[model samples]
Target: MKINPKFFIGLGLLLIIGYFLQDLVLSDSQYIIGVKKKRQEKDDSFRRVNGSPLSQAQRDTFKNLPYYAPDRAYRLDAQYQGFTLRDTLRMATTGPQPEAYLRWGQATFILNKQEYKLTLYRRAFGTDTTLFIPFADRTNGLATYGGGRYLDAAVPAPDDTEITLDFNHAYNPYCAYNNSFVCPLPPAENRLNVEIPAGEKAFHE
Candidate 1:
């Protein structure tokens, strides 16, 4: 009995496709795992470090930082709108001096049928691609810090126009734990009317 050569050729193609599919799935899974590991390491460092924002009393009894369950819904891909004339933004801090920030751009995203816009900022002398997003939501003064939380967005590339806003990575400013640290208050424009239940919660101290 002679086996058809075409049958073997088709089988070879199927095997190749399956192998690549498996590789792709594994690669994605690994990426998610890496994100989780990095987050855990950061939390661990904050809990164990002597110079962490956590108060000494909290650190003594701290096992882990309070955080909402990781929800992908809060992780959004924003449409970046560049500002033609960059304006200076005065941000109030916990201290006497008001920090000056440059308006980098605005990220507009829709969550739960509500359209929200957040102003992204960069330090006057900041040369890096990190955009600071200090925002307050309805959760403030309740579940999260009253001063608000912050999220950092890094441009994936120099020419990249889009960015990822991962609320799961939002953290409280150092002032939330220790008053010695001068934390910039979230500007009124960055305040969102919606409730963002994700990210770090309010500190008890």
Candidate 2:
């Protein structure tokens, strides 16, 4: 019995599509699992008696920190523009004292069809390789920490022009849990007009 050539062709195409669908699902599942594991570790740290950001009283009653569902959409690829002459930026904190940071660079990315830019900072002292981004969005005071959220990136090499900005990993500053911790406020420039609904949510609500 001879099968039609068209039948075999259609079957092969279906198999190929099935394989890609399976791979896509597996990739997404792995990403979500990784996000959850990191969040769990953070929650455990928050519950720790000695080093926790929570007050001793708060730690005693701590259960788990809240988080938004991990979403790949918030993981963005940005064009990075490094500054030739870095300037010192005194970032305001929740407390009266301000902290010093270097205005190291900027990241530009498109979200929801609108382009936005955020300034990245480095510690003023010593050679710090971390790019710190403290930002406020429309989600603040509603779904996330009212003070703002933070994202950290590796300082890209001078020639590197692109980097990933994963808002899925954005987190609340320690001050969100305890006011005693004086966290840096998101500078006016970093305050995004858009809503970022991914990552950690308000501790209270």
lDDT of 1: 0.85
> Which residues of candidate 1, in runs, are more than 4 Å off?
1-35, 156-159
Candidate 2: give the clashing pairs. none
Give the range of the ten consecutive residues with the poorest summed lDDT in model 2: 45-54
lDDT of each: 0.85, 0.92
User: What 10-residue stretch in candidate 1 is worst by lDDT?
Assistant: 154-163
Q: What's the distance in Å from true for residue 166, model 2?
A: 1.2
TM-score, every prediction: 0.79, 0.93
Among the numbered candidates, top lDDT falls to 2
lDDT, candidate 2, 1-205, per-residue tens: 9999999999999999999999999999999999999989888888877688888888878889888899998999999999999999999999999999999999999999999999999989877668999999999999998889999999999999998899999998988988778899999999999999998899982
How many residue pairs clash per model? 0, 0
Please give the TM-score that candidate 1 achieves against the real structure.
Answer: 0.79
Off by over 4 Å in 2: 1-4
Task: Encode model 1's per-residue lDDT on 1-205: one tens digit a residue.
Answer: 9999999999999999999999988876775676577678877887876667877677788776678876777889887887778799888998999999988888999899888999999888667568899999999999999989999998445466777899988999988878889999999999999999987898774
